[model samples]
Every structure is written in C-alpha cells, then in structure tokens.
Target chain A: MLVQFYNVSKVYPKGKALDDISLKIDRGEFVFLMGPSGAGKSTIIKMMFREEEPTRGQIFIAERSLVRMKRSDVPRVRRGMGIVFQDFKLLERKTVYENVAFAMEVVSAPHREIKARVPEVLRMVGLEDKENSFPGELSGGEQQRVGIARALANQPLLLIADEPTGNLDIDTSLEILDLLIDINRKGTTIIMATHDRELVKAARKRVILLDKGKVAADYAPGEYLVC
Target chain B: MLKNIWYFCREAVKSMARNHLLSLATISTVAICILILGMAVLATLNASHLITRLESDLEIMSYLDKDLTADQASEVKQALEAIPGVESVRFVSREEALQYLQDSFGEDRYNLEETMGKNPLPDGYEIKALDPHQVPVIAQQVEQVAGIERVNYGKEMVNNLFLATKWVRVLSMAFIVLLSLGAIFLIATTIRLAIFSRRKEIYLMKLIGSTDWFVRWPFFIEGILLGTAGSLIAILLLAVGYETLIGSIQSVPFVPVLSNRALLIEVYAGLVMVGALLGVLGTYISLNRFLDV
Candidate 1:
C-alpha cells in the first residue's frame, strides 16, 4: 500500500467535512474519487498531500505518518508527489518551456539536467512545438498540458489531480484523460477527484463513491457499471 | 547555487522593472531619509570639530608680580610646567608684552608708546593644559603658586560652549536614529507591496515544494538593490553639496569644517553599508508573513 487513511475525520465550525473515512491505495493504481459538490472529495485529496489535517485519525503515505511529521519535512513529502489543479495554474507571462523548467529550478536542479529534461517532458505532453508560446497565446487544453508537463518535471511517484478537467470541454477532457492514462501506465499512482460519472465510466477503473462526507461504495472496474 | 542566485537576481530586476512606479517611490523615500540623516551627522561632526579647535586655542594667562626679577620669572614658568595637567608654559617678558601692544595699535603705535614712557606691563606665563576640561583646575593651581598675582582663562565662556556642543551631539544622534526607523518602515512597505502583487506565484511555488529560502531569495535581492541604490544617490548628492559648501566657506575665519577626503570616503562607505542593512531588515520583516507555507 502506498497511502492508507484510518478512520479520518474533519470538523469545521459549520459541520463535519469528512466523517470516519478510511481507505487505502496501492502502488501504480489509478483510483477515482467520485462525489458531488460538498461531498468532501477535495478534502480527502488534500489530506493525502498533507495540505489538510484530519481532526481525528491517522494518515500514512508510504508508511510515514503525516499527522506527526515536522513542518520542515512537509516540502520533502510534497516533492514526492505532483498535484494538478482545476484552473491550470500557469504563470501567464512565462513561456511554456519556462513554466516547466521553473519547477526543476526551484528544487536547485543542475543546469545540464534542466536543459535536458525540460524539452523531454514538453515533448512527452505533445507540446514540444508550443514551448515558445506563452499561456495567453495557447488554448485552454494546451495550457492544461503545460500544467501537466510542469507537474511531471520532478517525475513524482504519485499524481493527485483535483478536478483537472473541470474547465475543459468533453473532447478536450477525454484527450487529457488519455494522457493521464498513458502516464499511469508508466507506473505512477494516480488519484483523480471529479463529479462526472461519464468520465469515470469511460476510465473503467476502481471507484470510491462518497456522499454526505462518508464512503457510500467501493467498486472495481465493471462492477460500478453493473450496479 | 550560483545559478540559483543568478536566477533570483534576474527575477528581482524584472519585478522591480514591472513595478517601476512603486520602486521609484520607495527609492526616493529612502534617499530623502538618508540625505537628512547624512546632513545631521555632518552637522554634529563639524560642530564637535569647531568646539575642539576652540578648546585647544584656550590658554591660561598668569600675571607675575611686578617686583619679581627675570630669574624669579623663569622659576615661575618652571613651577607652572610642573603642574600635573599643564602641557607647556611660555614666559612673556615685559618687553615682548609691550611690543605686542604696539603691534595691536597699528598706525597709532607711536602715540601709545609716547603716551606711556615707562614699561609698566607685568610678565606673565601662558599655560596650556593637556586636557581642555582640566583647564579650570590648572588655573586654580596656578593662582596658588607664589609670585603669580592672578590667572584668567574665560571660564564662563568655555563652560557654555561645552554645554552647547553636548546638546548638538545628542539631538543629531536622536534624529539619525528616528530617520533610520522611518527608512526601514518605508522599505518594508515597498517589499510588502511587491510580495502582494506576486502572491499567486508564491502560492504556486510553495505548492510545488519550493523551499522557504527559494521563495524568499528574489524579494531579498530586490530589497537590497533598492536600499543600495537609494543610499548611493544620497551619497552622491551629499558629496556634491558638501564640496560646494566648503568652497564657499574656505575664506571664512575661525570656522573649522571637515574637508579631509579620506574621512569623507569613510563616512560615505558607512552610509552605503547602513543602507544595505536596512534593506535586508526590511525584506526580512515583509517576507516573514508569506513564508509560512
């Protein structure tokens, strides 16, 4: 197991966001967190990366307890995984090449390695030709590809995408899903949160359905469609 | 590490150019504050220098009894020199004293010499003390010496001058400290504004696992650049103004101003160092809030 959540719960002043939620994910597995808005899907994804802490439970990523980790160690943990956002957070002024290279630069990668890896990752995302284009000049799908390239720059072992296709159209969304599936086949664990049932059905992967801050069902491929 | 620093510097310069108006405002504020501070320091330095010159010029004049012979006068000079605080003593004979008076009379010297036929001036010793503050005590000791009839050193005037110079030093020090605080505050606000404009980028950087120092380096470099630039401008202005003032006052008598090139260079160097320090302090203050991620 790569991630394990034991009886995790979160409480806000309004009410509980996650109640007694326990789940596990294995290495190289592609899991879908299916839930409607306000169903605590984002909260679970946040907890995996240690962005949000559970009110009462233990969270282990690769056997290290996130709840007991030091503040200084948070960045080291985050570097082991990549996060994709809904809006495609790319610096508008930077070219596609620079946007991706900035990630490695921040981690103090060697100059030669950065020069070699940036174009390779951009090419992996099929954006090698758009390297010189700024975000403002690219379409929404191209920008999202840039975001993915930047996330993959560090070659993390796991990728947590929260509504990564929420802003894209149906065709573009499918193309992104295909790209993610290709990445997952290359042995990176993937957890994507979304409310689109059609997208989940298309992936035909393991699905964990959440409702009212609790787990409603956990189904394997084809089992969710049958039910 | 060198590459990272180079990247940080490039980012800093780019951000500064992007926010040129705010950067200009911050630089001007720093320049004005430092200019006033430099002026206050120069005033204090020059005032103290003048006071020192005046004190060094002070001498105790002790009159000898008219009945003392030349041999006895030389003995009195030796006695004054033996005093603990006395640096040196010079004997003024009656003839030299008369000659001094004649020179003071200038064109009327003949009339003064003919009006007083006999040489009635008394012999005296001019006494210099090692420490100006000890002049009063030395004068008292000299008055007690035998054959010394009286001593005069303008005690009240010296005391008043010392008091005035003390106030000048204290006030200027206070002014410089307050101005430094103001400069730091301004730089802090400027850096805070810069941080605000790039807050989203900072958030993304943190989310991507950038270390706190990585996120902080660009802003730190920006603050340092702002501070160094402001101080350099102020120093240039100050140097030009001081040279002009010195030129205008060269012919003025009894005013001891600072004109040494090496000392001015030292003061300028000190100002630049202080400006850079203020920049670092301001950056630290502003960046503390955003680095928690």
Candidate 2:
C-alpha cells in the first residue's frame, strides 16, 4: 500500500473532523472519497499528503511514518506527491510557466530539466500554449488547468486532489477527470475528494463514503448513497 | 546570491519608483537631518580653525622695567628668545615704539615723553610660542626675566574664546547624534510603511513557498535605495548650503578657512555614510518587525 491510515481521528476541540477511520490503498489505485460538505473527505486526503496531520492515529505515506517525519522532511514528503487544490491556488503574480515551474524550483530541479519538464506537464493539462498567461487573465477552467499542471510538474508518485473540479462546468470537469485518469494510468496513486455525484457514479471507481466525520460505507464502484 | 541581490535591488528600485510620494518625503527628511548635522560639523571645524589662527597669533609682549640699563635689557631680550616656548622674539625698541604709537594714534605722543621728564616707553621683547597651551606656563616662567616687570596675556579675551569654542564642540556632537537618529527614524518608518503596504504581496510570496530572506530582499533593497537616495539628497542640500554660505563669505576675505574644498568633501561623504546607516537601520527595523513574524 502506498498510503495507510490506522484508526485516524482528528479533533479540533470544538468537535471531531475525522473519526476513528482505518483505510489502506496500494500503488496505482484510483479512489474517490465522496461526502457532502463537512464530512471529513478533505481531511483524509490532507492527512495522506501531510498537509494537516491527523489529531490522533498513524498515517503513513510510501511506507514512511508521517507521524514521525521531521520538520525538514515535510517538503521531501510533499515532493513525492502531487496536490491539486479546489480554489486553483495559482500564484497570481507569476506567469503560468513560472507557476508550474515553482514546484520544480523548490525541489531544486536543474534548469535544463525544468525547461523540458514544465512544457511537458503543461501539455498534459492542455495548457502548453498559455505558458505566459497569468492566473487573473485565465478563465476558472483554464486557471484550474494551470493548477493541475503545477501539481503534475514534480512527476510525483502519488496524486491527491481536494475537490479538484469544483468550479468547472460539466464538460470541463470531465476533461479534468480524464487528465487525472491519464496520470493514474501512468502508475501514480490517485486519491480524489469530491462532492460531485454523477461523475463519481458514472466513473464506477472505488468510493469511500463519510458522514458526520466517520466512514459510513466503503463501496466498490460506489455512488454518493450515504449522504 | 548575487543574482538574488540583483532581483532584490531591482524590486527595491521599482517600489521606490512606484511609491514616489513616500520616497520623496523620506528622502527629504533624511536630507534635512543630515543638512543640519553637516552644518554643525562645519561650524565646529571652522571654529577649530579660528582657534588655531588665534593660537598662532599669540605672542607675549614683555615690558622692561624703567630702571634696567640698555645692555641689561638687551641681554634679557636674548635670554627670553632662547626660552623653550619662545619661537622668536621681536624687540620693540623705545624709538620704534614711539614711532608706532605716533603712527597709530595720529598725535605727537613723542612730546609727552619730554613733558614727563623721562622716556616712558621701554624696550620690550614680543615673545612667541609654539602652542597656545604653553602660553600660561611659559608666561609665568618668563616673569622672572631680569629686566621684565610684567608678563600679561589679556586673560579675559582668551578665556572667552576658549569657552565659546568648547560650547561649539558640545553643540556639534549633540546635534550630529540627534539629527542622525531623526534620519534613521524617518527612513526606517518609510521602509516599514512601504513594506506594510505590500504585505499582500509578501503573504502571497510566503504562501507560494518563498523563504523569509527571499521575501524580505525587495524591502531590504528598498531600504538600501532609500539610504542611498537620502544620502544623495542630503549631500545635494549640503552643497547648496555650503555654496550659499561661501558666496556671502567670499566677499569678506576675513573668512579664508571656510573656502576649503577637502573639508567640504569630507563633510559630504560623512553625510552620505549617515544616509547609508539610516537606510540599513530602517530596513532592519521594518524587516525585523514584518518578515521574522
């Protein structure tokens, strides 16, 4: 398994965000975590990526103990995974090329490697022509494309998307899903958090359902039925 | 790192250009502070020059006692000239003194000598010394000269000059410190406000994973620009002030020392350094408050 969560629970003093949940996923698996808002879907994905640690229980990534990871190793852990955010958090000041290139820059990729890899990732997201465009100049869908390109820039082993297609239209959303599918088929483990029902249902992927911070059902080829 | 600094400096210049009003106000503040400080320095410098001139002019004029014989007075004059502090002694002969008195007063003072039934004027040695500090000590020792009756130095005038110059020195040092601090505060606050305004950019940069130093470089460079610009402004102001003063002083040939170019250059360079210090200090203040957090 590339990621494992053992009795993972997160408490925020007011209430729990994720209840005692245990799940495991191996390499190259495509899983959809479906839940309505505040169902702890994002928390699970976040914990897997170490964006936010579980308040309790052990979370593991690539057989490494995330709970015991040193502070300096956080970036190293993150470098091994790709994250696509819902808000399309592209650096507004930076161009599309620089936005995608930033991931490579932080990992200290050599210049020649960045030059070759950036355009390739952009091409994967179908944003190869908009390299010089800024985020504000791009439409929401196009901006999200740039965000996805940035996430793929590191050619990570694991892909985590938190509501990745929230702002896209139906057709645009499917295109983004297809991009994620393409990436997963290339041997990257993918965990996508979403509230979209039709897409998850039609895709027939393995689905984990959460309700009130606890995993309500784990279904193969699941739909958003637990809601 | 040099590349990073270039980017930083470029950003700094860009910010300075964009925040034109703020930059102008800060630069003017620094210029005014340095200008006042530079003037005080120039004053003390000129005062020191004047003191040196006065010290060089000091010569002890010894009056020979009327009862002394001509040859005895001559011998005492030679001995007085040979004293350690004594550089050279100009003997004011009685006849020469009489001629000098008549020439200065425009009257027949030579007739008063006949009326008094004795030559009132006595031959005296005008004793010179290497330093003004040695004057009192040398004067006291020379009082014992065989034909000398009095060794006077017009204590009232010399004491006033010393007191005045001592006050000028105290004022100069105090003024310099206060004005430099003013410049620092102005430039620092300016940089802080500049950074505060661009805090959104800062947060965006941080969120995008720029290290604290990389995030701070622009503001730091802005500070360097402020310092460099403030100093240049201050230097310019000082030059204008110096020229205006020199123009007035030029017609009056009595003020020869203020015409020095080397001292003026030194003062301008010093103001430039003060500006640089203000720039660095201000940037540090802003960065320490904003970036480290």
The DockQ figures for the candidates are: 0.60, 0.14
What is the lDDT, from 0 to 100, of the residue B223 in candidate 1? Answer: 85
Best by TM-score: 1
Q: Against the true structure, what is each candidate's TM-score?
A: 0.87, 0.68
Work out the iRMS of candidate 1.
1.2
Q: Candidate 2: global Cα-lDDT?
A: 0.78
Model 1 regions lying over 4 Å from their true place: A6-22, A47-58, A209-227, B61-85, B92-122, B136-151
User: What does candidate 1's lDDT look like per residue over A74-181, in tens digits?
Assistant: 888888888888999898888999999988888888889999999999988999999899999998888899999998999998888899999999889989999999
Residues A31-63 of candidate 2: C-alpha lDDT, one tens digit per residue: 999889999997787677665777889988888
The CA lDDT of each predicted structure is 0.88, 0.78
Candidate 1 lDDT over B1-293, as tens digits, reads 88889999999999999999888877887788778878877887888888888889889989999889888888888888899989999988878888888888876638565788788788888899999989988999999999999899998987887788789888888888988998899888887888888887888888788888888889888888988898899999999999999999987986778888898899989888888788888889988888765
